[model samples]
Target: EKVAVVKEEVRSAAYKANVVKAERDALRLSLSVQETTQKKQVEQLQTLIEVAKAGNQDYSISNEESIKQTLNVSEQLNEQAHAEMQEMRAKIARLEANASSEIQNLEQKVKVVEAVLVGEVPAKRMRRRVKTKMKAAGV
Candidate 1:
């Protein structure tokens, strides 16, 4: 009977470990997906800028200022995207580190299996962070 109990405990620990690993994997996967999407968007912005530059050359001088402003806006967008991507990468690194340490701490706890048995999976990963844009002073 003792042998059976020990075996069950071992299995529970293994299951918890697997779940923790899966959670970490899911987190990392999400960051990679976001990075890929952001990279593609940056590429698109570059193409748009190039197209705008070529278009500006063909426009009359009277429209030159407008095209130049458009080009400037496109450049600003590219810079902003790159900055956001870098910030996101930093966030992923921090989150990954925290998750690894959390998993280690959780491994030392004995009741993880009960949580598992009752289907109490952690839902923190599903939360989305929202950033509201602030309006400029003039528009």
Candidate 2:
């Protein structure tokens, strides 16, 4: 009778341990699935960022006024897209201004380089020509 009781006690303990282990395994699997889902969401957000950057390309703008209007619509939508649109507009505006400034600087540098190549024309003469062109263009 003592031996039988001991065996039954051992079996009961083993069964309880197995049940507890199974629950732990299930919890681990649930946690893993949740992690995977969260990772996918993060990747999707990254893709949206890339798409927003693409929209900032200057060549893509057919008409600035029309685009500005559409931007106004997007701003009204309060969609996730609105944030991206606003960000792209601000970045593109800054980039365009910088690019225009750089282009002007490069043009001036090129004229200086040309003067250097063609032998000495006084700096004053080149400056006069550039100034005249700018005045003519109202810039």
Candidate 3:
């Protein structure tokens, strides 16, 4: 009878030890899963930070390029406008010169007509022709 009782007690102790060992293994596995998940999350956050920094740099570079292009276009427009203004001034000066020459020609014609009418030059034949035409026209 004592031998049989000893065998039963040893079996019970072994079973309880086995249960404790299983619980410890399950806790160790849970901790390992949590640690790995946290590591992955940290790495992902780090990658996002780097990407945001790169994007910010790209934005600044693009802005600089945009400003440069705008200035270049503005300068080109200004140069074209200046050239057009100079061309217009030249055209106006030519027109004024032509008008002055036309006025001088008209003034000379007026002077010749006055000299012909006033009988002050050596034009006796022109005076006799005008008198004959006036008499024929009944003026």
Candidate 4:
């Protein structure tokens, strides 16, 4: 019964790990899409800046500032995504370790139980005491 419970717990942990992995993959895909979009925007901004320079048009200082701000925001977002991925990876590692430890403990318990059941564990002391009690009772 206890072994079954342990098995169930192991299964639960494995399922949770897979769920986390899927979430991580989704987050990665989101970040990748965001990165591509940001890159396109940056390239378009750079082209506009170059065209303004070539045409001798006075580029608005506000435009430059806006580009800088956008780049900064993108960097921040990338950093945040990277940190979140790291955290998820760490969580998965911890869960795997816990599951492994639980399995080892369960295996050890099963081994002991099997040994006891198979009479590999010594029962001589108990047998001796029981025999003494039976002799005293004149059985």
Report the C-alpha displacement of residue 43, candidate 4, in angstroms.
5.6
lDDT of 2 by residue, 8-47 (tens): 5445555655565565566556655655665565556555
Model 4: per-residue lDDT, tens digit, 25-123?
A: 776687678668767776776776677667756778787787778767767776776787678668767766766665555555554444444665467
Give the worst 10-residue stretch by lDDT in candidate 3. Answer: 1-10
Q: TM-score for model 3? A: 0.46
Local accuracy of candidate 1 as per-residue lDDT tens digits, 1-139: 4334434655665665566667657766776676577667656656765676687667465455665676567667667766776676676666556656554444433233333334455553421110011011110
The CA-based lDDT of model 2 is what?
0.53
* CA-lDDT, candidates in order: 0.53, 0.53, 0.54, 0.64
User: How many residue pairs clash (N, CA or C atoms closer than 3 angstroms) in each of the candidate models, in the order given?
Assistant: 0, 0, 0, 0
Listed per candidate, the RMSD to the true structure in angstroms reads 18.0, 35.5, 52.7, 9.2
lDDT of 4 at 75: 71
Question: Whole-model lDDT, candidate 4?
Answer: 0.64
Q: In candidate 4, where is summed lDDT lowest over 10 consecutive residues?
A: 130-139
Could you say which candidate leads in lDDT?
Answer: 4
The sequence of per-residue lDDT tens digits that candidate 3 reaches over residues 67-103 is 5565566566556655665665565556556555544
Clashing residue pairs in candidate 2 are none
Most TM-score-accurate candidate: 4
